[model samples]
Structures are given as structure tokens and as C-alpha cells.
Target: MTTTTATAEATTATDVLIVGAGPTGLTLACTLARAGAAVRIIDKSPEPHRASRGKGLNQRSRELFDDLGAGAEAAAWGTERVTLRKYRDGVAIADTVAFGDRTPTPDTPYASGLLIPQWRTEEVLRRTLARYGVEPEFGRELTGFTQGADGVVATLADGRRIKAAYLVGCDGGRSPVRKALDVTFEGRTDTEECMVIGDVRVDGLDPAYWHQWFDEDAAVMLCPFRGSTHWQLQGMPERDADGRALPPSLESFQRLVDRCSRRTDIRLSDPTWFSVYRINVRMADRFRTGRVLLAGDAAHVHSIAGGLGMNTGIQDAFNLGWKLAYVVRGLASPGLLDTYEEERLPVAAWTLGLTEERLRAVTEGVKQAGVGTEAVVTDDVTTLGVGYSWSSLAWGGAKAGERAPDGPCGDGRLFDVFAGPHFTLLGFGRGSAQALAEAGEKCADRLRTCLVDDPTGHARRAYGIGEGEDALVLVRPDNHIALSAGADRGAEIADRLLRLGR
Candidate 1:
């Protein structure tokens, strides 16, 4: 490949060139680096983001972080069991638990979400990425790119060129890569509906609950950031006489809070970050065009009603990481990369619809029933139940394409065995040991084989294997079951493995 810019100083090469250093891009970089892919990640911003943009991690995303070796650190900085305190006319009306009700089961270890700042989550990811000897190159912006049959050549703002086998756009909603591809972003932006959001320090306010005050026309919410004195503030944007929304400022935030809560004891100051948030429900027409792909907000965006924005992006990186790594490593054909969009596109569509519904519920519920935004919260928001059974890779029964459940195996849990940059094969009974051994010997570098010896039968039950029945399960690197079959079908198992790029 050749660059169009003659002034391009030098050409650097890598297996993958990722644009954007946000949570999604950082997660992808960590995954690819751990999988031994030569990755180069860059961001236009000179420094890491300091704002707490998306302030929560769902159960599914927590699992992804755990696999990346950053889960414990993220959890340490997060707060669980936070109470939602509602107020009306400065009087406390109701108090409800947000994520404290869920209990962890053997099959689902992370049943609850964590409340952590977005900047903190990015920090954890960056720390993990450093372990793999890769760091995002900040202030290196992608000015343009050209892709040929073999690879892509990206031109940066500094007149440098990066040649890579693949390019992924993890940039936010206004993605330059997506625009360069001429891809259509299909959906609408609700400019009329806007909110002023920021992180601020408050004095004389208790941090025990996520305080929310609601009146007939407006509302203000202050959620304390876990492990920090700062809190995230969200309220209606102040509008001028002509109905134009004013720019967000510390004074305007204070006025909104005082008017909504009717409280004089609270004081707000030291605004670290602030922005005007508008709902944009949109998704790219396609996730891929030749050697370039899109992930995270570059692919889809929705309302922040259910806090699914960042979690969905994290999950997107998890799903694409393994497939992209395999293709780069020559373990799979380029066609394997197509499955990334096939599997995740539907998920993005579902999330857009779900969040839009929740946004409507919050708006209408507040006016009709005096309900808070917490009314939008549901078990579905956890994303634990999301599956891709309809994908072409999913084969044989309901368990296929579903997330591999965690259960007790030997001394540790199933996740302990599944955590890594390799696929997993679980032989449920002695009858399947031979097949497991053969598959392991053939694909030793890319697959991990386990013979479950769970006396409590919890693992078998979670996997949908009947008591005393023999079965073989093949799980993808991302921990989704690719296929399952009877133990006796050893030849079929081998055939499927070979077809899956073993």
C-alpha cells in the first residue's frame, strides 16, 4: 500500500491500526495485544478523558473486564448497592435499591452492575493494555486513509503514515473513518431534548444515596461517584426566552438544582467537566467495508436512559477482539471477520430499540405517575441474557451461541478455566476424553480442553446437559458456545473444529 500524501514523513506498520483511545478502543487494544497481535492505537486528544461520561458497568461488561484482567481493579473503584433517593418539593418521597437486589449465582458470577466513573474505567483498561507492551498514541489524529487489496495505509495529522492489515474505527459518534467510508448512519437526533450533565463537588450533601429531585416540569439528579468525592450532576438545560438552550456552566447547574430540589443547604462548585447531552438514536448501515471496520459509538449510539451506551461498546470490542485476532494470526479466513457484524449488528439494533423505549418511559412516567428515571431500569439492562443463537456460527441446540455459564469445576469456577486468549472445549464425561485430547493436541496453541468433574452437578445443569449424559461443548474465545454435540460424535466434532479455523 502507498500513501497519497507526499509529505508523509515515515510509514509504520502493524497488524491492526485502531483509531480512538476511549473505552471501546482501549478494550480492543488490550484484547488484540494479549492475543499477540501487533496493535497500534491512537487518539486525537492529547490527554486521557477526565469526565465520567458513562458512569456504570453492566454485569456482562464486568465479565468482559474480568477476562481482560482489569475487573478487580474496576470493581475496587466502583460502588454497588447504591440507593436511589427520590424527592418531591424538597421532601423525601421514596428510596429504592438500584443494583443491590441481585445475588450472584454459580452460573452467573456477576449478577449486578458496578457504578464507576468512565475515566476510571478507561484508566483500568489502559493499565491492562500496558501489561501487553502497548500504549495508545495520543494526539495522533487520522487525517485520511487508503486501502488496497493487501492492507490499509492511514495518514495522520502529523504527516505520518501507518500501514496495517486492518483498520478499526472505535471513534465516537462523529467518526471520521465512518464518514470517509461514506457509510450511512441511519436514525434521528433529538436536538429538542437536551440535558446539562457534568461532574461537580458538592458540600453539605450526603453521599449515601443517588439523590434525585423531581418536579412537574423539570428534574435534577446527583449521583455520587464511587471512591471519589465528586458527583455526576444531570439536570434540564436552561433555555433563553427564544427557547435556545444555554451553554452548561457551574452557575446554571446550581440554579437548576436549587429550583428543582428547593434546597438551600446544598452548595455546588469546582466543575471539572460539563456538556450538553442530546439523545441520538442511530446505527451505521453496516459495520464493515473491506479492510476497515467500526465498533462502539462509531457503529451505533442511543439514549443514555438505561446506561447501556458504554457497556454495549465494551461488549462490541469483546466480540470483535477474538475474531480479528484469529484472522490476523492466520488461524481463520478473512470470512471469519464477517461474523463480527453478523453477530453484533442485531445486538446494536436491539439496544437502540430498548434504550429508546426506556427513554420514552422516563419522560412519560415522570409526567403521568411522578416516576423517576429509575423506572427505566430493568433486569434486561444488565445484558446477562443477551445471546446470538441466530448467528451462522451457532450450531446444535439452545445452548449454542449463548454465553458460557460459570460454575464450580474442580477447585475453582468455570470462568477460571475459560479466562484467556483461547477457545475452550469442555468434555462433560469420560466418554468424550479421547476427542478432547485429540482436539487439544491438534490445536494446542489456540484451544484449552477441560474435563468437568463437578460432583454437585451445577455445571452440567447450567450447560443443559442431563444427569449422567455425555456431551462435548466448544466455546469461542469470547466465551460464547460455538457448538455442542454428543460425546460419541467425535468425527463431527473434529469436522466442526476444522471448519471453525482450527
Candidate 2:
């Protein structure tokens, strides 16, 4: 209800105050702003850095951007990676493998992963956020926050305060917001987290290929970056001569690369970014608390096996954005915010498990044997397939547990009939037209009802309707099929949301 401008007053207000301007926070801010929510996003850093971290944008994430009109721009920054060749035992045996078949079906537009580095992804998000007329408040940190029945209030380091209907923590693992909430972060560090990561400017190297050497003791990964022949090299860190884990000296880094590939011919110049680190797999206790919530790295973090970090966080923002905006706009009940945790928490846990499995595969020598590189890319669970197991609109009209597959559809236009993160009704034939019309009247604001372009009337039968037969499909905001029924009888659809929220 109130906000303040005085730094000494320590009170300001927003519909939502998001902490951390990384992929997750920024995405949520963009969505909320577009939907007309008063949002404020802050980060501890003063500026966006060029350090590229997670570098892969999965198919689902790209589709998410397309809905917001930024997909094409985001897509342009990434290159498609068809295969990842891993040579075992220091020998270059298995080569490049073809892996493109597993993508979006005809109904969906994006199917493949775009291999753009994380820094560029942030740049694209920044550009899109500007269109919303809200730029992230960098260098602004959340000192702590407390919640009340009406809203939440967050404090900045200089003692400024912000009041908001809700507060979301998308900050990284060392999240100040999450820490203030005192939520438990569970899971072990996988003690054998033997991984060293850094970026380097490699001269004279083809900046198109990803080279992996799974040698005797160490595993090395080299990815060629765009705009420069410089590559991002990652490998297991070696202990110093005294057995202490030391930073990778220039000589050690070059030697590690040389030993893994069995080649000292390629020279290593000054490194751009250098760091030796351990990988830990962890997730939060819960994603919500009263008016405060957690997302992205603040909620969960895992091994970077398939480049799922940024993608997972970005999706978290997508899942929470519309919900927060709708509630903020008073268009929906406040219960919608609960769905953010129910839907995204499982996704985070699933991703953690998937990445752990992949980490094991590489660390434990679990190879496909006969399955080539193509299989690995799809089999790599870091690429997501998240669904709402607890939302009200759980039944897709066609079948139970069947996702809303993007298809040629009852519509004639190729990829034209797209359902977004909301409720939609597709009427096939005129059979169930009455039912659709009736249902459309009840929830005109919450659901979309349309007659399928069925000239032959097969759509009506397929939708469980007789001649002039019409059936209804209820889609969730995430574009997943929830339920399909006759228009008048579909009142029970609201009951599903009740159960999910309760």
C-alpha cells in the first residue's frame, strides 16, 4: 500500500521485488512488466559481465521467448550443436555424431538447443527488458526482508526499503534473500566434485567444434567460441607438486591440455579467465514462504553436465512471471502464486537428478557403447521436459497424461495454432459448439474457446462429440493440456485449480 524514496526512511513499494538480475530474475521481471505489474529487479553487481557461464538454450526456453517476441533475437546469438564427440582413454576414437531428430513436433516451433554462451543470453534479455521500460537495478543488494499478510518489505545495504506484494529470490547459490528467509538447502556436495572451469582466448583454433578428451586420469572439454578463435577450456584440476589444490598456473594449464590430447604442438598464450573449482549438486527445501519465493540458482543448483543452469533458471522465471502478474493485477485469486513452487520445484529436483546422472556417466565411464553422440544429446537429462503434475488443468482433452503436443492441428496454418501459458478451448467441428459456447461464457477471462477448422468433421469425433459434435480442451498457462469437456459441464475445471492450490 505504501513506498518511500528516502534512503533514511528505508521503505519503498512494488507489486514485486525481485532479487538477482541474472537470467531468472530478469526473465520474471520482463514477464511481469509486460503483463502490467509494478516490478523492481536488483543485482549486487554494478554491470553485466562478459563471463560466459551456462551456454545452451534448450528448445522449450526458445519457445518461451518467442511468446514474448524475443525468440528470434535470442536465437540469432546461438549456434546449433549437432553432436558432442567424447574420445575415451586419451584416444580419439569416437568422432562427431549426428543428433537432430529429437526436437519439437510440427505443432511446436523450436526443437533444438541453441549453443550461445550465457553472457550473450543476458545481453538479449537486457535488450528485451528495455522494451518493457524497466531496466534491472544493478549493484543494488537485498540486505534482508520480512513479510506480512498484506505484502513483503526488503531492505537494501544502504538501509533503503522496498514494499511489494511479493518478493522473489532469483539470486545465485549464495543468495542473500534465501538466506534471510532461512530456508534449508539440502543435498551432498558429491565430495569427488573434481572439476576446474575457466574461459581462455585460444589462438589459431577452429571456433566451431567442441572437443572432449576422456583420457586416463583427466577429462578435458574444449568449446570454440564465436567472434574469436579463443576457446573455453575445462578439465579436471590437478593437485600441485606439494599435493595442495592450487590455482592453475599458466604452465599447468598448458600441460593439462597437452597431456589430455597427447599434443604439445598447440601453444597456450595468456588465459582470459582462470579458476579452479569443485562442483556441488544442491536444491532448496521449498520454493515459497508467505509472500516471498525462490527461483533459479537461489532455489536450486546442480552440476553443469548438459548446460542446464541458465536454462532452468530462465524457465523458472517463465513459470512464475505470468502467475505473479495475474495475481498482482487482481485478475486471478492469490492462490496462483502457490503454483510457482509446485510446478518449478519438481522441475529443479528433476534437473538436479538428470545432471547428477550425466556427471556420473562421464566420471564413472558409463558410455552408450553402441549409442553414438546423437543419443547422448537427447539422453542428457539437463535438457528439460517439465510438466505440471499438480495443476488444476491436469487432463488434456484428448487423453490422460498426454501433453499438449504442437501439431499440424485442426488449424490449416503451419505452426499457427499455438496455445500459450493459459487456458484455451479448441472446438473441433460444430458437434460440441454448444458446450464450448457455454463454457466460454463462464470463464471468458480465464479460458479460450475456439472451433477447430474441421471441414470433414473428424475433429468433432476425435474430440468426443457426435454430429455438430463439439469438445473442449482446457490448457494451462504453461500451454499444457489440463482437461476437455462439454462447455456447461466444464465448471468442474475451476475445481481442479482449487485442489492444486489447496
- The lDDT values for all models are 0.88, 0.69
Error of 2 at 329 (Å): 0.7
TM-score of each: 0.96, 0.86
Native-vs-model 1 lDDT?
0.88
Mind giving the per-residue lDDT tens digits that candidate 2 earns over 1-502? 2222224433436899988888888888888887788999998898886666777787778767776667888777677754555666555566563345555444445657777777778888888889988999988877767677778777788788778888898889878777777789988775444566667766544455677776555667777656544566777777868656657665777778788777756667766667665677789999998888999999998887666888889888887887887787766788878767777787788888887776666555534332222333554443434667465435544443234544444445212354343466666545657766666776666566666675565444443456654456665555556676665545566555444334
- Candidate 1's error at 28, in angstroms? 0.6
User: Which residue ranges in model 1 land beyond 4 Å of their true spot?
Assistant: 1-12, 368-370
Clash pairs, model 1 backbone: none
Worst 10 residues of 1 by lDDT: 1-10
Off by over 4 Å in 2: 1-12, 87-91, 101-104, 366-376, 379-384, 393-403, 409-422, 434-446, 454-469, 487-502
How many collisions between residues are there in candidate 1? Answer: 0
